[model samples]
Target chain A: NAGVTQTPKFRVLKTGQSMTLLCAQDMNHEYMYWYRQDPGMGLRLIHYSVGEGTTAKGEVPDGYNVSRLKKQNFLLGLESAAPSQTSVYFCASSSDSGKLLSYEQYFGPGTRLTVT
Target chain B: DQQVKQNSPSLSVQEGRISILNCDYTNSMFDYFLWYKKYPAEGPTFLISISSIKDKNEDGRFTVFLNKSAKHLSLHIVPSQPGDSAVYFCAASWGRSYKYIFGTGTRLKVLA
Candidate 1:
């Protein structure tokens, strides 16, 4: 089903440059999330959407913005890229059916971003 | 504050041996815990999980154990093989929260 897919597997941006990351899922999940993984820091949530047309801040939402206009797509935007933003970003989707299996998330291959 | 923690940065185990990875969480509100495995250049995949109501959950060669009192959980892989080598992450979530707090991954190296 291609599960979840993320655009631009890799990218390099200069400080103050802006760009957007796109994520798509074919599973019709009701929940979508954006997370960044830094060396020895694990994956920290930047933002998440409980459903289409809704978004919420997470553990580390600074320097990032998100939008979920459609049920199958979620987008993460960087208004002003910075060197500290260099990391591997992952997009994940899951269902919110209150079922045990629903808690398991499907992730994309990840987008490696480097901001200089 | 780091809610979830994987103390060991890396672990190595001989083939056919048991590989146990440990995780600890600071929040008692966490009712569900999960383990994800990631290979180089790939995203993390679900491995196994355990809920607060159950002490253990087993699936094929993988098993997850939860000690509620200690606020600790562990993933065990029996007869570890070279193919099982990867970085493992532990995540925790409370109630019906869709957000998960992840721990710094622990890299596992299974030597054949």
Candidate 2:
């Protein structure tokens, strides 16, 4: 299995530029999540989807948007890139079985985004 | 507020010794705890996990111990190898909640 894969392993964006990060998973997971890892802080959830077409705000959802148009794909968009938005982004997938904490997450390699 | 915390930023252990990484959580509602190992440029991989009901869970050379009273958990790797050097993250989550609160992560290095 390819597991989870993310696009644009590295990128540099100027302020005001827009871009999207793509995440694709072949594990057929029912849940998808987007998280950003900063220097001192742990990975913080930006947005998540329980399934396709559903998205919800996480701990740090500001300045970012996400869409799960397809089960195998999750897209994270930066409408207007800012310096503070620069961080290593990771995408994860899990198989939810309706039981609490029943699934373990599989993460992608990650995308390093630098906004100057 | 940081729900999960890993006080130690890094730890150094001699080869073939035991490496103990500690993690604490303030949320009593958390029913599950997990440990993830991450290499420098790679994503974190699930190492081991334990449920609230169980005080200890063991898998291979990795063991996870939970202390409910202290709200603390730990990951112990016995006979550590050089390949085991990596960043370790602790995560907590409650029933049916897909969101996991992660700790700042502790870097473990095994000295040869």
Candidate 3:
């Protein structure tokens, strides 16, 4: 079974362009998250969803929007891409058993997005 | 301000030697700590974790030490091997929630 998968492994977008990154997990986990990684900076949370039809803003959710329309898919959308938005995006999922401190999070390979 | 901090950007150690990666957090409310290892072009993977109530936890060659009073934690890899080389990240959460604050990862190089 594919634990976690992200679509569009690589993409390049010009400033003011828009795109969406899709993340799908087969684990049927209740928690899904989107994070961006930059040089010297660890993964920063962009957005998260605890369950389907529920989304919440994370630490760095300024220029991103997320939708968890289905239980297995979490989508991150860039309404207006900026140069600063160029970074590797990672999607992760975990169970919502209230024991996340012990359970591990499954992550996708990541999508490399370059905004020029 | 970054609530979690990894002072050393990178570390190098000879094979079979001990490798210690340090991490500090400013928030006292953080009760759960975890360590994740990532290879180049891959996502981070869970390595080990420790609860605030515990001072130390060990699993095989990896050990995680937590000091709640000082808001500090560390990961120690004994008899480091070349395969152990990777970017190590320390993350903390306040409770059972999924909101984890990660520190600037420290790249560990194990020389063979």
Candidate 4:
């Protein structure tokens, strides 16, 4: 069913460059999130959206911006890439608020971004 | 300040043995905890979860135990198989927050 899919599995960018990572989910989840994973560092939240047309800052949102214009799509943008931003980025979605349901996150394959 | 911590960076166990992975958290407000498994080049997948109201939750070969007093949680995999070799992450959340604090992750290698 293609639960969650991320475009551009791999990408490389020079310092100061910009790019966008696309995440699409077919589960029709209301919550979507962007996270980065680095060696010895667990997944850190970059940004998240509770629903369409809504976005909020997460744990580490310094160099990233996100948009959830559509219910099924969440876009994460790197305005200016930096060496510290080079890491594997993951997109996840959950059905609802962290209440009745356990809010289990379903993740995509992930996008590997390298900034030189 | 990392809230969720996985003390062990990696663990190796023989197949069919019980594998226990430990996790601790500094935040006392956390009410929900979960475990996720990840393979090389793939994203983390949810394995199981436990609520603060409960001390333990089990699903097939996986079990999660939460100790609120100590702010500790663990994932136990019984009869571990080679296929269980992967990175395991522990995450915690409080109330309605959509964000979860995740641990550094423990790489489990189940030797056959």
Q: Which DockQ values do the candidates obtain, in the order shown? A: 0.67, 0.73, 0.63, 0.73
State every prediction's TM-score relative to the real structure. Answer: 0.98, 0.98, 0.97, 0.97
Per-candidate Cα lDDT values, in order, are: 0.95, 0.94, 0.93, 0.94
What digit string (tens of lDDT, one per residue) describes model 1 on residues A1-116?
A: 89999998999999999999999999999999999999999999999999999999998999999999999999999999999999999999998657663388989999999999
Stretches of candidate 4 above 4 Å error? Answer: A97-102
Could you give me the TM-score of model 4 versus the true structure?
Answer: 0.97
lDDT for position B107 in model 1? 98
lDDT of 1 at A42: 98
lDDT tens digits by residue: candidate 4, B6-100: 99999999999999999999999999999999999999999999999999999999999989999999999999999999999999998867779
lDDT of 4 at A78: 93
Of the two candidates 1 and 4, the one with more favorable DockQ, higher being better, is 4
State which candidate, 1 or 4, has the greater TM-score: 1
True contacts kept of each: 0.63, 0.63, 0.60, 0.65
B18 Cα displacement, candidate 4 (Å): 0.6
Worst 10 residues of 3 chain A by lDDT: A96-105
RMSD of each: 1.1, 1.0, 1.2, 1.2
**What does the i-RMS of model 4 come to?**
1.4
